[model samples]
Target: MKKDYYEVLGVGRSATKDEIKKAYRKLAVQFHPDKNPDNKDAEEHFKEVNEAYEALSNDDKRRRYDQFGHAGVGSSAASGSGGQYGGASDFSDIFSAVNDMFGGGRSRAGGGAPFGFEEFFGGGGGARKGRASAGIQGTDLKIRLKLTLEEIAKGVDKTLKIKKQVACKECNGSGSKSGATESCKTCNGTGEVRQAQKTMFGQFVNIAACPTCGGEGRIIKDRCTSCYGEGIKLGEVTVKVTVPAGVQDGNYLTLRGQGNTGPRGGAAGDLIVVLEEIPHDLFSRNGDDVVYTLAVSFPDLVLGTKVDVPTLDGAVKLTIPPSTQPETMLRIPGYGIGHLRGSSRGDQYVKVNVYVPKDLSHQDKELLKELKKSQGISPDAHNDPHAKSFFEKARDIFS
Candidate 1:
């Protein structure tokens, strides 16, 4: 059974066109596919909303529906009036309603009214000729660059060899050995072709690049022998890149006009370098901070000792204070990674791990027994804070 159109939009039959449009806008926005993705109920409700609007929004349709119900509106309710109601019509109408709500102006290049969904979701196809051009832009390229912690701490320069399209040297990007050409007859030098297509919405004109001259608007009379009339060839080029300090993994550096050259004499694109961090053996990165674990003998921890600690710059002497805890962390300022585009440097954190002897010799055991007696050591000494345990403190490092 068909539900009442007035009930669907939650408006009276006496509602004006502006009221109908306003009600439909609210319901359409609430159930739009972009807002309620993967929801079947919202999709169906959205269809119902559009169908109700299509009928009530039109005076003739609304009069026929009011007088004789679905039968009076004709086969529109059954075949969905070729997208006048629901299903595929739902998707297109949803975008139409959205465009109206946002006050979007339709494209005037085509003779027929614009299908909002086709223009909104589907990227501009060959239909719109006003924005068409003869010169094609080159495609952008991406490359992965692996950097070490040291390189990230200190900005480094790298030379990259890339394979890209370069303008042919033989004809100087003209694609002709004799530099002779004639205007294309197929597109009439417009560099595009327009074709008319009939749809449910009416006649629509589609524009595409000219097939004969490949959108160049001219035909090559004499082909270049080196590039075979392509006007471009694959070649290797070296690019010098300066990676900034403290750049994290997955960050990108863009080099404009450094990618493949366009066909003929078109403009070149960009080359993007994505950064990847390589792990270090002794140090791990935490934001701008460097984390390193330093192992010291039990005697060194009790009596205090000076040891060399590894840093982003170099190894430096770090003092372990007397009676220091096994899990104690020491911070050295201005010894870690440098700030990107800034003058400040980060600090390095060193964690201490005390080492205990696993085996004891006879003389060592005799001295330990005398010391234990003098110190009044008990069997439960393992529970002491200074005693070695299997538990280890975990550190979270970004790298």
Candidate 2:
């Protein structure tokens, strides 16, 4: 037997069109599939709510509903329509009306309007179809890729073993039991459902996906033994991705159609790989330039000298200008990372560290004593007003 349209919306036959609309809005929000997520009960309820609202919200249909009851009004039950519309009416109508009220782009958490969010923005019109482009896309998956400094500089290829969610071979995403499919009992095969409640705010109704059938508008009487009727399985697969040189950390690479398989054989979503770079112990990168530190003798700082320093290319001799200050920095151009798009390489910088011997030989002590006396300087010269100690001077030297 058909339930009364007013009863479907939990309203009296005398309810005003505004009352019908309000009731439908409440039910649609509560039962939306995105809200219910994977829960079968929520999905089914979601469908029922939409179906009921479809019948009672339109003036013509609502009038017909008042005159002939549920049978005379004809089944619409979705949030918008007259008797002229049916199961194939644009699925987004109810959603669009809700969107106008919500005042925001579609919510990532599934819009508050179960019907309004996904159904509204995902795409729709007043038609159902067999169009080639029509179908659900798979859910995208993410993986973090770690790159070494050298590998990033040179660019590298990596083969990864990743598991993606694919539709079950057993039921093909039908969530069915065996080969037997049945109409959704909760939604009555309309794929939508509605209900009303009295809250502090007022009397309201909610719509949601049909729980009994998970919004497919049909039920699986028997479960697929392999998938237990859920219709998706976890499988492992290997894929190789090429990491381009100069790939920045936190950047993502997308492999199209490499994500989870869509339900009902829809197009596959993309796989997103996030790149992360590992820090190097021997080298520090400053933009394209590399930085290195080499120790030198005090005499080298005063007299100046060429010292061998390690670079990405190899050990190169770095010349310090005469009377070069301790911790002076020198640039060796074209010794750093290569330009991502150009032929040029970045420059490398070398900082000189001047050190005093910890242990003095008899000859060294004599030489230093004579040298200090000749220069009118004492062993405590570092303690003078103008000088700082070796440890404290590193900052000044480097600075």
Candidate 3:
């Protein structure tokens, strides 16, 4: 059954372009096949969602779906089942746009992107033409690396030397040696086969792509040794990438044309770099704020002193008032990582944790006793319900 596009994205029918994109990106990440393996239903729903997004995300298709519903919007797909959507639409485009949802992320033309010629001119081999026989685009690549908090604080550009695949220079992307290929005879090299069947409803005729040549309309005899008939060779390539400041974990930067080369001189695909922020030993990032845990001695907190504290911008002296309680957080404005596109920087939050003396000598004990007696107080007076005596909690947690 056909489902409404808005329903698939969980958005209202009047959603704007930005809202639609947000919803699609969320669902794509959630129901992506990599995230939900071993579940056939989820995988199917994922594909459906991709298809819905692909159609509605486009202006023309969205208008068509809005005015004519699924029937008018998808009639090409229904009838194109006989063959392909010759020119009006490119099935291969649709397939590549949604292939990530399927376990087989490969495009119909293997690693290459679909060609426009297949959409413009219906090849003689196939009865109906869409993108079924379109040339393929290159493959997308993913690389993961760790980044330090300081590196993320300031944007950086890095040049990485890596290995991947490229089109076979020896064969010129033909997968054959010195023009050793010829038209396939299975379906007369048309790359498609036609058949007619009589049914009760009507004499239904079905037109399908040629299976023998794999819809390429040609056959290779002596394959190229460089790519082993795949028309792509493994090689090393260098790519320069810029890491924007304030980029969070799981954020991706796309470097186009850095992927494997396309067959027959097709354009190369893209390389996606996913950033992973490493936790700093002395600092943590909260949104745009830099946080550091500063330990203050009990005497320092009680006597009131100006102590040096570390911040992203460097060390600054912070004043601690007398009788200051533990767990007091102080903020330094405009000291953290600068907003990637904004004018101001994030603030740095210093969390003060007053440390109580754990090892007390005889003289220290006597001095504490005398001080408490002078104040007419006892150790029990320090008891706090928010996790018995903050000092004890800190000591227990740290030790």
Best by lDDT: 1
Q: What are the clash counts of all predictions, listed in order? A: 1, 44, 13
Q: Model 2 over residues 1-399: C-alpha lDDT tens digits?
A: 545556667888778878878987887677665566556676555556566676666677767766777666553443334322222222344444455654533342243443543343332221222334312456899999998877766678999999987777777665554556777788887554555544332333445555554455666667777766656677887888998766677978999988886654456779999999898777788877778777788777778887788877778988877777766778998887766677677788887788878998999999987888764333565566555565577787898
lDDT of 1 at 53: 83
Question: Per-residue alpha-carbon lDDT of model 3 for 1-399, expressed as tens digits?
Answer: 777879989999999988898998898778766677566676666666677777677888889889888875675433442132122123334444444333233223222444432222233224323444323457888897578878788777888887877878798776777747778787776666655644332232344566666655567779787777767788888888889889899999988989877654445778889999998888888998899888888778778889888876678878888877788888888888878887678888888897766899999899888877764344553555654677677889999
Question: Where does candidate 1 stray beyond 4 Å?
Answer: 1-134, 357-371, 374-399
Poorest lDDT segment (10 consecutive residues) of candidate 2: 122-131
* Order of quality (lDDT): 1, 3, 2
Candidate 3 residue spans exceeding 4 A from truth:
1-135, 179-209, 219-221, 376-399
TM-scores across all candidates?
A: 0.64, 0.54, 0.56
C-alpha-based local distance difference test score of model 1: 0.77
lDDT of 2 at 171: 73
| Candidate 1 lDDT, 1-399, residue by residue in tens | 877878989999799999999999999889876688778788778777888888778889889988988787777754574254445535555546655753453453233545543353333344324433334556788999999999999889999998998888998876789877789899887777765655554444556667787766778878999988877889999999999999999999999989887776666779999999999999988999999998898768878999999888888999999988888999999988989979788999999998767898999889877877854334454466554342222222322
Count steric clashes of candidate 1: 1
